[model samples]
Target: MIPLAGWLLAGGSLASDPAPTQSDFGGAGLWQTPTARMAEEGELSFTANRTRPYSRYNVTMQPLPWLEGSFRYIAVTNRPYGQPSLSGDQSYKDKSIDLKLRLREESRYLPEIAVGGRDLGGTGHFGSEYFVASKRFGPVDASLGLAWGYMGNRGDISNPFSIFGSRFDRRPGRDELPDTGGEFNSATYFRGAPAFFGGISYRLPSRPLVFKLEYEGNDYRSEPHDNDQAQRFPVNLGVVYRIRPHLDLSVALERGNTAMFGLTLHTNVARRSEPAKVLDPPPAVRESAAGRGADTAQVDWEAVSRALEDNAGIRVSRISRRDAELFVTGEQTRYFYPAKGVGRAARIVGNEVGGDIDWFTWVSTREALPVAETSVELSRFDALLAHDIDLDEFRRGVERNPPLPRREHVLYRADPPRFSGGWSLGYSQNIGGPDAFILYQVSAGYQAEYRFRPDLWWSGALNANLLNNYDKFRYTAPSRLPRVRTLVREYLTDSRITMPQFQLTASRRLGTDWYGLAYAGMLESMYGGVGAEVLYRPFGERWAVGADLNWVRQRGFGQDFSFRDYEVATGHVTGYFDTRYRGINVAVSAGRYLAGDWGATFDVSRVFANGARMGAYATFTNVSSRDFGEGSFDKGIYLSIPFDLLQPRSTVNRARFVWAPLIRDGGARLSKRYTLYTLTEDRDGDLFHDNLDRIAD
Candidate 1:
């Protein structure tokens, strides 16, 4: 039997093994020793219980003063799996790990402030979890937490309900249960929710009673499979009773996920230390501004991705989930004439937003522009505001438009702003291999523009495609990158052109960091290109240098089918530079085109960074394939710098600038750039100029 001397009493009762009273529920306790005392703490607890057909075991330990960890693993090997079991068979297993740490605080301030991390055991599917923080001041305590969680089961539990009742003969001789339901994949059961939870609780002064309340819910947009856009809120109330000097019991009824009845025992690890009366140190004099400490280190892209899905189920399975969003864009270009239309100025504005909820609907309106232009403006605005709202994720989506598309053309007054309204929808699901998945997307949009060559002309394009990525082999275009980011490759096609194209790509790991890949895509445009590249890593590292060779052919209005005139071949050597502090990557290349167009190129970017990031790009191309234009060795240069303006403690501010100069014949060709800004969460606008050479000439 447990000793009773270590335990204290509440409300005049002194039972040998006391039950928790209402006071102990929320952090309320009567002083047993001195009113003000210092103390060290260490504690451990283990519980084993049998809830009818199933048995559970749980353990909690605190190895450090500010850290608490808990582990719970459950296994049931019975046969009756009806009702809650879903699977009639009787084998269910799950394990979870939870860790929490307290932050440092002054003696007079709240000391219960803490950060929490959780990882579900290798049971359900990939791992899923959340980050939470809480604080308590005097008789009041409150907490807030964000959770990105995936709920799904892992390996099949031997539950009678899960067994296929029709397929297996089950004539008293079968050992393995036949695959009946065929819906065992975790994807079928797992649901994704982005939840925010916060609540307040208060204690009654001088009484053994405490009152507490909380609210929790998720904000989830529609995905390819599930379109439920709903939020949940629950409430809870509980009380605790202190039996002896060392034992405590508690019970609570909650409408939310934490609803449970639990009993706890508390003991003084060591006698409370005497209160100290040390003199307060004088405040240090303020000096010049100092670099913020690591605590001020901002959350980068990698941190956000890791927090999204970190679970055993997610780590083990090869299933992927995707979301489809639709948006509309409108932009206008203005041109400024230098003496005689030598230079032009332009401006672009757009509003985009749309999503589907499972049962309802969701919509948002925001602005978007190329990265180079957005980063610059954001930097100035960030210095003005005081918060950090991620704008890079949006910038990333806009950069996929090939660098030269529409950017090389000069603006005309007769033409209206570049106004386009388009819709894009895509969805992808993963198969069961380690990293296997299938994806598809359909996009169609129209733009109204006055064609300079063909006066008063308008045109539009429609797009549709499917892609697959499994543990075995996958295929995509050269423009496509690995789908490691969000399970979806941003490119519509690979490196090859795709009016209507098909491709197959496969790769295999040779060791740790070494891998080999092969890809082939068919093109439908009048012009087509066939190319292949090999990647090699001598030391098996994440970074590597490689070379590629490509031969292309083009058919123009007048083509005699001559190699010297219509066929072209080129070779390029490539290397990558990765930056961690600034969250950027630079890919540099030196290549030669058969048509005397040989130059070096560097494509660098500040991918995910705090404050702001800028990318300076420089490229020179001489001579162009007749298909592009009728010109002799032409020299061109382009530059763009991007950044994220983080307010002191608010959403991000963004801006950027892009400039390209081309020297043809003895003058500049289409020399100009643009600047874009996104001030509101879902609003965007921009300003641009053309014929910039007028300033130089």
Candidate 2:
């Protein structure tokens, strides 16, 4: 019977767990602890829960089918990190990272099984390890688990692994004054007596509510900071109300005395609204080219170029005719899908050129260097557009070929304006540390650009602070390494208005698959630098590689084009891989950092179809954990959300948010403004093929 149950569970014969019916502290569960349930893939949630001495703000994401990760900040009102200073009142706030892995899915006669670690990275004051299983029958769900460390403080049973050695009988205490916080405290994990906990949840019929009851294992007498309290009852009770599809409210009674309240906001990043197109009508397809005449005059070619740019969003550099084929060289902008730009250009060409033109070839170029060429039969294209025919037939005829050698008979060339400017409002923030909980600023900036040619340009930005609280940013972490990034207070408080960036950039395509870029300027908030990068990305390939080099001088606190004495040279060789699994991408960079530390960084992210990207990265340098200061290393999570998701019209703009536990000097990179790989992304055909339906627009 046991073997049969195992086979069923392995095959995932049972329905997946439903959405959270009750809050589990700050995640998905019943009351005080998590269940064996996992959230849906691509789910992003923010949860805030409070009860007496503890309040937790958590950001969680299910980036894969069998994995869940969360970053949390817990504020302990009863304790403070240290005596108050100019940094403002100090509260005992702890930053923790958690993860869970699913082992087996539930079946008709079996429960889902998972293993998890909480407070895995931090001071380890509330660290715990557990293995849990859950199952559902009708409207009721039940879970059971065994826990160790703080969760097993009751010490109800003997040490489970004591048979191996006497050292496994007791958990080791954590470092009380460590320089860093993210080091894994393995010696203290699952090394003590174990305890059991269980819970049950029931859904109410005809109502958007769920009731929960749980038996907690921790006795609360072993809490950190000598802030322990008595637990009158082992059971916890709670209820959750689903206020809307994206919101939930929960309240719980725990320890038979304290009341807990939680609110959760969640959304699926993979789901997005349909494309919001403009009201302009699509270009009309001509039935025949009978009346069109071939005029290779320079004026005629200029008119054709204007038609392509105004109607099709293609900026033409040159146009020529050779025998029965028409060749146009240009760059594509404005459309998310290159196929749409190509299709629109084809229709406009057929409308202007004579019937003798049998083929239309477009040479896609970036920075005046041709990358790829696509050829289409003008006769077949017109037929597909004018009649009811399979669009696939037209797609099959489209050919991606190498660029042809230079043609001699150019009819027209464009010379565009050299200057443009705009104004925008932007915001920046720092969060989650012993320093003030958050330091933020809102500013308005005017940006201007001058183009020397297609491959060279100059850009600058001047900012005025409209609102800020930088005077409150006083705390700085202690570190043995050079203070490459910890002088935030001096930088922000120097001036209310500043010039964050001003640079001149030059870029060019070196070969069919190689691109290069060079720039010099005040690159970012803290430094002015000169850098160059080269990338080799083949069309439609899953992997690419690039290298970069930079020489920089630290900027003065005034942030007005003045340099300090500090100088450094840093660079990296980076590789990128697209897994092709749910839009996951992995990048690894190895090089020297700003503080002269050598290391590698690993980043993984998933980009949804709607252009929303969620990712995390971690850096490990040669510096020891203690020397690296808080966080042990450099790590953070970021989200880039497309503006189109909130706007009524489609746009390519995005807003980015980043959260880091601490800012240190060990593994920091120069923040360059642009890269060649992103500039030439449309050279690949996959993105265009994925959105073929937009070709008409």
Candidate 3:
């Protein structure tokens, strides 16, 4: 099965009923012209296109109904990457970010309208800005747009902004310096002469073919790297072959001279569903209340505890019964969704209790600390077995809140596991850097955890390199700031068999609405630190705030376990918010960085229905662009995919992949192994909203 990963951008239902198609540039458009169209929300695609001297690869995501974002890499085959001695025979590559916003939706009397910018906040290689409108007629989609800069090199129309000042009369030429480009040049935006462009798409009914023609605003009179090519005509023609629902092949003739070929892979994350858990054991049969007897001693607590762990994915901490309610306390381990654990627990307890117990409450815990609890009316649950009530009706009768500090009538205390470990394979890589196209390593690793108690534990990871191509990682960019993150090459090549991280961590419940965490020892591959954090998150609320502080010393290149003389103190005060709409989350952190720089970071992401989070983050500080080197700032994109999606049995573990255009030394944060916010997410009440469908399963 193909893995579907995504990131945020504008989105909406496809225009004109299945009208939007992936353009050669990987956006929704026709050939070289953009249209006011969008992919369905939660849609993502990877596209590669080639035309003459240029080859472009793009990854586009639509996380919202009115936003779209794309990250692209353009390789100019005709130009050298840098001095031949540094990058021999390597083609110059430019990495850029793009965004499109839908300003107006199509209506009976108006065309859909959108505004966007290309190669934004990056090198001016293909920088441009435009606003376009698109409408659909029977079997055809039409789009018209006005653009500035590279896309409008034809200069067919005067700059509309020229009325404001003479500064708008000319577009600043791109700098010829060999420096890496990533800073945003706002002064150059919408400043050049403009041009008008239009295009149309023709789709045959009941067929898998799509035909398109576009009037391009860019002429081949001048090009990036001063490599201009001749054009035979002003218009472009293209065709798309839909080989499968998620795959497309494109062929196009642009500039009447250049032949283009492209491929696109697409998927929608919002509508994904997990396969039925046929292998999981069925819920225990409901019992007759009168037959179980009214005496509590008749209950086999040990047997019931084992059943909960085996059948409901919950590891029991303790069990107790009040006048009419039974409370089971533990952490969910097997079900990726906590609600599923709750549902299964309800079924298992129904078979153990009788007429005496009228309600069931599960106190969910993490690190043996109670975070939240859910109470369910047994009568409502029993009705589901009799088909007299639906899951939604039963859900309405349930109640949940923060865990209260009290214990009574304790029946059983579970024996917690003391030791756990696992073996796995790992792969890491560096890409799109000017020095080399890719530098990678593969290894076999083992991770183990030993819990002294439920609230305290020691853990470590040891890895042995199996394969790597770090020989090509010879260049290290000079940094005026401390080398906090740029020494990645030295760490990777220092040792073959090494333990990069070894730490001891502990967590505690400070109060009903607060949590505390602390850790010490070897923290990560680059540094060793001791840190503590406190979080104040209300029970079942949508927002939280936290603060953390740490003191760290750089690690030796031996990579096994050694410290360097360099040390610093760093931390952040972070705020987290959940919009409660489409799982959109926004996070901001401000404080001192690893390099002793003051800055703040902004992260925005969307959590899909399938336990996947797609997000991007950017960090800026007082460090100047010249001192920060390439990238001008710190930024990257990441996708965290739930383990359950790749296997039959459910597991909450996730595999994360990160991509950064360049690794710099500024805006670096301490890599804390565990965070209180994530540890207590199950208490936020989103668990039920995200996993409500599992209630009846």
Which candidate number would show the highest lDDT if scored against the true structure?
Answer: 3
Higher-lDDT candidate of 1 and 2: 2
Candidate 3's displacement at residue 99, Å, is 0.4
Ranking 1 against 3 by TM-score, winner: 3
Candidate 3 per-residue lDDT over residues 322-394, each given as its tens digit:
7888999998888888777888898888777777788899998887778888898988877866789887787
Candidate 1 global lDDT: 0.29
Clashes of 2: 0
Q: Cα RMSD to native, each candidate? A: 28.1, 6.5, 3.0
Candidate no. 2 TM-score: 0.89
Q: TM-score of each candidate?
A: 0.25, 0.89, 0.95
Q: For residues 603-624, could you state the per-residue lDDT of candidate 1 as single tens digits?
A: 6544321212224344445433
Task: Output the worst ten-in-a-row residue range by lDDT, candidate 2.
Answer: 5-14
Q: In candidate 2, residue 407 scores what lDDT?
A: 50
Among all windows of ten consecutive residues in candidate 1, which has the lowest summed lDDT?
342-351
Q: Once model 1 is optimally superposed onto the true structure by TM-score, how far is the C-alpha of residue 367 displaced, in angstroms?
A: 78
